[model samples]
Structure formats: C-alpha cells, structure tokens
Target: MDRDMSVEEHLGELRRRIIWVLATFVIMLALGLWLAKGAFDYLQSIPPAADLPLHAFSPWSGVRVYMQFGFILAAAGTMPVVLYQVWAFFKEGLLEREREATIRYIPLSILLFLVGLAFAYFVVFKMALYFTTTVNRKMMLEETYGITEYFSFMLNILLPVSLLFELPVVIMFLTRLRIVTPRRLQRMRKYAYFALVFIGTVITPPDLISDLIVAIPLIVLYEISVFLSGAVDRKIRASEARGSLAR
Candidate 1:
C-alpha cells in the first residue's frame, strides 16, 4: 500500500541518510589513508618527471595529505550514496511518473563523473602539467616543491573536470523534462563554443596550447550532449503526444 510521508518523517529520513552517508565517508577515509601512497603515486605517474625533492611543512603537510586523500576518496566512494540522497530529496518534489523515470539516471550520472575525473587525471591534467612544466623549466632554479602544493594542484584540476563532465547528463535530463529542445541547443552552438573556450582559458594556465587542449574535449562533450539531447527530446515528446491522445 502506498502511504504519504509527512514532513517530520521526511526530515527524519534525511537525517538518517546523512548519518549513513557520513559513516560511508569515514570508512572510505580510513581506506583512503591506507591507499594514500598508491593514490599519490598514481597521480605522480601522470607528470612523468624525475624525482624532484618535495617537502612538507612537517605536521601540517602530513595533515594536508591525509585530508586531501580523504576528500578524493570520499568523493569517489560516497558518490552513490550522495547521488541517492539527492535523488531521494528531489524525487519528493517531482511527479510520481517523473520520479520513476529519473531513478535510473543517477547511477549513470555518477559513472560519467568518475569517467570525467579519470580523464582529467590521466589525460588533461597530465598534458597540462607537461606543458606548464616545460614552459617554465628555465625558471625552476630549485627543482623542488611542496607536497601540499602538489596535492592542491591535483585537486584543482580534478575537481573542475569532474564537474564539467556532467554536461551530457544535464542535457539529457533537461531534454527529458522538456525544459530544452535540441533545436534550441543547436541554435546556440556558436555561443556554446565561445563559452567553452572562455572557460577553458580561465581554468588552464596562460598558454595557447593548454587552453586549446581543454577546450577541444569540452567542445566534443557539447556535441555529444547535443546528440543525447535530440534523442531524449524525441522520447519525451513522443510520450507526451501519446498521453495527449489518450486524454
């Protein structure tokens, strides 16, 4: 039997979900600490450089590493729980049919986010590092760095790419909701190109090559979004037309 949930009940459930999510994050944090070195090494593999002496400001550096590893792992490990909670909350606000339609999309969105982060870590981030390091190689009198700074840079690149990679999911959902049409998105193609180029320039270092590298993938993602949007638009429109006919 279906029963309506009260506001108090919903809040209580949310609190419980938050606790579960936090517990998941803590467990993931411990696991991350155990694998911190491996994670660091994986990130290091991308830069393709000789052993450069890296320092940590003692206790603070140690803390930074622990926190950084925890953040990355927590984001990765708790993503499903996080997405579920988000869906749960938003689903309450949506029509029953819409909620049911959206249930399966969350996991796919999470996968896309991970793919984006991995691409950033392995491809875009590495390329950016290579380009930047080579360009400023002449300025590095000391050939040494801080571990905290290194991790900070890693996070900076990883976070944005992961977020940006959600474009396809966003397009799909907007299409599903009939909020945007493929024709409209297509019409804005020139604007999207400029917007992506501007964003890439802002994120990447001040170099033509770096900006182009970042912008190129973004443009491709936009084009893919356009395709997905068209498909979703057709599906939603067909569903709507069927409903209208039935009425």
Candidate 2:
C-alpha cells in the first residue's frame, strides 16, 4: 500500500490477503457447524422443507446436509471480510476518497446478501417448490424426499440467486480494479438481461407478473452496477486530471 513495492512485495501482500480470507472462512465454518442444527431446524419450520418429510436413505445424508448449510453460511459470513481485504489489496491505486467509497461496500455487501437470501428463500424457492410438488402430484407420483436430495435442490436454487444479488458489489469491485468499465457493462446489458430473465422465468411461477417481479430487481441491480461503475470511473478520471494539472 506504500506504492513502492517490488514484485515480491506485491505477491506477499496478495498472499497475506488470501490467508486472511481463508482464516475467516475457517472460523465462520466452525461457527456455522455449531449453529447448523438450529438453522436446520428453522429451515425445516418453513414451507417447502416444512411440507416435505425428510428421509435419510444414506448414512451420510445428515452429514452432507450439515456440510452444505455450514459451507454456504460460512461463505456468506466471509463475504464482507473478503471485500475489505480486496479493497486493502488495491489500496495504493485508489485516492483517499475513492478508497473510502470502496470500503463502504463491505457493509452494503452484507445488506445486499441478506436481501438476496430473503428474496431467494421466500419468493423463488417457494415458487419452485410448489411447481415441482404440483407436477409430482399431477403425475400421481409418491413424493418422498431424501434429506440430502432436498437440501441439494434447495441450496442449488438458493445459492445462485443469493450470489447474483452481489452482482452490483462485484461490479463495483472490478471497476475499482479497472478490470471492467461502465461502458463494457453497458454493452453487455442486453445479454445480461437475457440471462437474468431466463433465470427469473425458470425460478418463478410461470406467470408474467411473477417473472417480472423477479427479473426486474435483477435487471435493476445490473443497472445500479453500471451506474456505480460509471460513478467510480468518473472519480478516477477526475482524480487523474487533477494530478496531471498539479504536475
């Protein structure tokens, strides 16, 4: 961060950041394991999991389910830490104001993630559960769900949507690194919409309103990402111009 680092120092800094992130992950993973039972019970108290009776066909079914929740919970807990570390790693390149702006993402990322988790769980996951259950019932199939299989389906649906909620943060971080620009995000807007819409349609109940409800927020997040990226880019350019003028 002194901006006088040799290549070796840069590598060493990166290594330290990685270590910190990993350490946080490990600590959170332990906490997650300790809390998984209560969390697991809470998940079961809700719909979908509440409706389905869990069977443990394999001896490892319970363990696998525990691990899944633990891992995701740890990842979620570690997210803010990761963002801060990333910001620190690139500290030297950023102006003081820019650095402050970037650091604010640490908490905002947590808020966004919690929002994503709620949306995914309460909205998308429920709709998906209803659809699949309805189909199974319509086909006159007996619905017996293995504990492992259920969490697998649940997590698969939950994790991606929740993570996509972090798109804006990820975009902002990359923008800070000068890896992606506002213009680049703008160019990809159409494709991004297509993909997000596809995901929305796949997850939601097959209704126009439902699709729009899910897709719109995701689309809006993308726009926000673009906007924030542009904001940071403008700041960076303005700072450079000032430096050049001073010189």
Candidate 3:
C-alpha cells in the first residue's frame, strides 16, 4: 500500500502477504512430506560425521522428521520472496536513495545469512556433537539419539546462528539510516562484549568451550559490523555531499 492509502488499505496488504506466506508453507509442507528422505540426508550433512545412529521414538517419527525437514527447506527457499514482499510494502514511504539502499542490502543480507548458516553448520554443530558424544564415547556407550530430538536440537543450533549472521546487514542498515553512528558503536565496545558473552552463554550448550567458541565469532562479527558501518556511513555521506554539490 502507498503512503496515501488508509489504514484499511495497509491492513488489506498485510492480509494478502500473510495469505501468500501461508500458501507457500502449505505447498512446501506437501512437497516435504513426499521428499523427506532427501531432505533428511541434506540436514544430516550439516554434522561433521555421518555414522551417528538416529532413532525415532514414535512409530511415525520418521514421517514427522521428513515433513519437518521439507518445511525447513521450503522456508529457506522462500526467504527471499518473503523479504521482497516486505521491501515492496515498505518502499513507498522511502526516499529514492533509501529505497535503493534497502534494495542493495538484500543481497548482502542473504550472503550474511548463508555465512551464518555455514558457521553454525561448520563450527557450532560439530562442536556440539563432539561435546555431547565425547562423554558417551568415553563410557563405551552406543549413544543412540532420537531422530526428532536430534533434528530439534539441530534446528535450535542452526536457526539462531543463521539469524545472528545478519549482524553486518543490520549494522549496515542502521548506518545507512544514521540511527547508529560508527563512533557510537566503538564507544559501546565494553557493553558489546558483555552482551556477546551473555548471548553466547544463552545460546550455546552448558560447556565453557562451547560458550567460548560461540562468543568469539559473535565478538568478531560485532567488530566487522562496526567496520562495515563506518565504511557505509562514509560512503553515504560522500554521496550526499556530491549530490549537494551538483544541486
């Protein structure tokens, strides 16, 4: 809906987007039910080792696992479409430059998300698995894991990290809007550290090593966000200055 549109019009647009998202989910779920095996295999690939036994607690847990896996794939595939719809809905209120800037952030956002997903897969998942299974291995245990629980754990580990990976894009947008200055972020360094540590503890498993591993990347990402924000702010200001000069 355009800015001139009434509240009813905006509500109509929201309803429409919601319908689209729901329809997408239904279609994906159906497809997922049919193709759960491949989906499960793909999800399993995120872990470092393949030999871990996966058991289903319920009689139909296998079906549930595959269906859920399909849904996950569907959600991932539809992310860009969802984001585009969101952008379209909001674009009318933005200046041309702002619209362009937001459009530019889309690709970077996707890239950052993928990076985060990879980080979760490569770093967190492996470490978590190692931590959990190491003790069992030491005890000479078989370590049979329930399929649903394992997948749920995997989701918990990956989803947050993937979401976290959007730090750069977030900081970039804030920088673009001048909501947060580079110097402001720099000044908040100590606070950021405490927050990162807190976040690491909250998200990771109870072990100190896991907490430390997760925290390090988060801190590094924060620094990266600050640097990128500084660069973006400089570029936006330079562009604005050039525009003023031309005018």
TM-score for all models, in order of appearance:
0.81, 0.90, 0.83
Error of 1 at 116 (Å): 1.7
Clashing pairs in 2: none
User: Model 3 lDDT vs. the true structure?
Assistant: 0.82
Model 1 earns a TM-score of 0.81
Off by over 4 Å in 2: 1-3, 202-210, 244-247
Candidate whose TM-score is highest = 2
On lDDT, who's better, 2 or 3? 2
> In lDDT terms, how accurate is model 2?
0.88
lDDT of each candidate versus the true structure? 0.79, 0.88, 0.82
Candidate 3: regions farther than 4 A off: 43-49, 139-142, 177-179, 202-209, 239-247
lDDT string, candidate 1, 40-148, tens digits: 7765554443345568866789678877886788668888888777667667656566677677778778888989888887777677666667766877654456788
| Residue range 158-222, candidate 3, lDDT tens digits | 99889988988888877766789999999999999999899888776678988999999999999
Sorted by lDDT (best first), the order is 2, 3, 1
Clash count of each predicted structure: 0, 0, 0
lDDT head-to-head 1 vs 3, winner: 3
For candidate 1, which ten residues in a row score worst on lDDT? 44-53
User: What TM-score should be assigned to candidate 3?
Assistant: 0.83
